[model samples]
Target: MGRAAAAEALTRVRKTLVSVPNLAKVMANSPALVKGWLALPGALSEGVIPAPVRERLAIATAQYNNCEYCLSAHTYIGAHVAEVDAEELERARDAESFDPHIAALLALSDAIARGRGRIDERQPKARRAAGVADAETAEVAGNLAPNLLADTDNEWPVVTPCTHN
Candidate 1:
């Protein structure tokens, strides 16, 4: 795409997200990539998972991937937007939760991120035991995609104190 398209993508991203993240700015260099990045999260938001659980999943996946940017961003979004408690946010980093269903989801997310999309057989069994259906378990990949995309290489010029204003 041309510069105009990239600029348009960046504009759309800012309008959709309400703020332009540094990663979004870098993604603007490839308009298609940035657009696709925006689309995945939008699509996943319509899935079975609750916003708070999804945010926890993102936190767990980010921690697994060692993406400081994603971890910080999701931590803030989890506590603020999703109303996840501070303790829950910290527990999520370890793929844990007081709610068993959410804990299962976070574990599944962490497994997916750690395995790089390949999970062990026992993981699904554990999730199923926790009342997670096959479908909801599958959606973990949907949540993992955007978190993984945020810093695929585990490197994104770490910025502490995620400023989301």
Candidate 2:
């Protein structure tokens, strides 16, 4: 993609006004990556799982990897946009959740993070028992992958503001 096209795409899909320098760096290096990153969240947003639950999964994944950028950004999104409370935020950071399904999903997130896409069979059982679907479980796993990428790419503590434009 040309620089103008990439910038336009980013401007069109952005959810906030703050610009991330590293994101621009990525766009310059890999427009396809930027395109996919922008698209995945929207696709997952259409999934059955609630946005907050998904954000929780992202939070847990970020926290587990010690990615301060992803952790802080997702925390703000969870709190202001998704209404995730303080306790839940705390739990998510630790990869624990009170909601049974969320707990199961968090466990799955941990499994994916640690195992690199493979999860133990027992984890799926708990997730299903908590009313999570096989497809949704997979979605949670998929949702976390890009977040991990963004987290790994950005600098620690993520100086970038919550930028969209």
Candidate 3:
């Protein structure tokens, strides 16, 4: 897509998200990628995972990936938008939670983010034993993927050399 199409995509992103993030703006160079980025989170939000849990998972994924930008943004959003408490937010950084089910989810998130979506068989069994059903366990990746994307985009931004007039 050309620059105008990318601009239109970014406009759509801003309308849906209420504000355009820097990462979204950077990804807008490729209109298809920018538009596709919005779809995953929108679909995942409609799934079984709660918003707060997803925020926490984002925190965990950011931390595991060592993305300062994603970590900070998710931490703030987790606390403000999700109403996650300070202690819980800190715990999320380490993929821990007071709630076992959530902790299980966090552990799965860490595993997926750390392993790059290749978790061992025992991990799933452990998550299941901790009251995380197969579906929620599966959704952990759904929650983690966007955070990883943001993490990658922030750490190494897409560089397109400008052509001056």
Best by lDDT: 1
Minimal lDDT window, size 10, model 1: 156-165
**RMSD (Å) per prediction:** 5.0, 5.8, 7.8
In candidate 2 the C-alpha lDDT for residue 121 amounts to: 74
Against the hidden reference, what TM-scores do the models get? 0.87, 0.79, 0.87
**Candidate 1 — which residues are off by over 4 angstroms?**
149-165
Candidate 2 C-alpha error for residue 162, in Å: 22
Candidate 1 lDDT, 44-68, residue by residue in tens:
7898888889888888776766668
Give the clashing residue pairs of candidate 2, or none: 16-164, 17-164, 18-163
Ranking by lDDT: 1, 3, 2
Query: How many Å off is the CA of 78 in candidate 3?
Result: 0.7
lDDT of each: 0.79, 0.72, 0.79
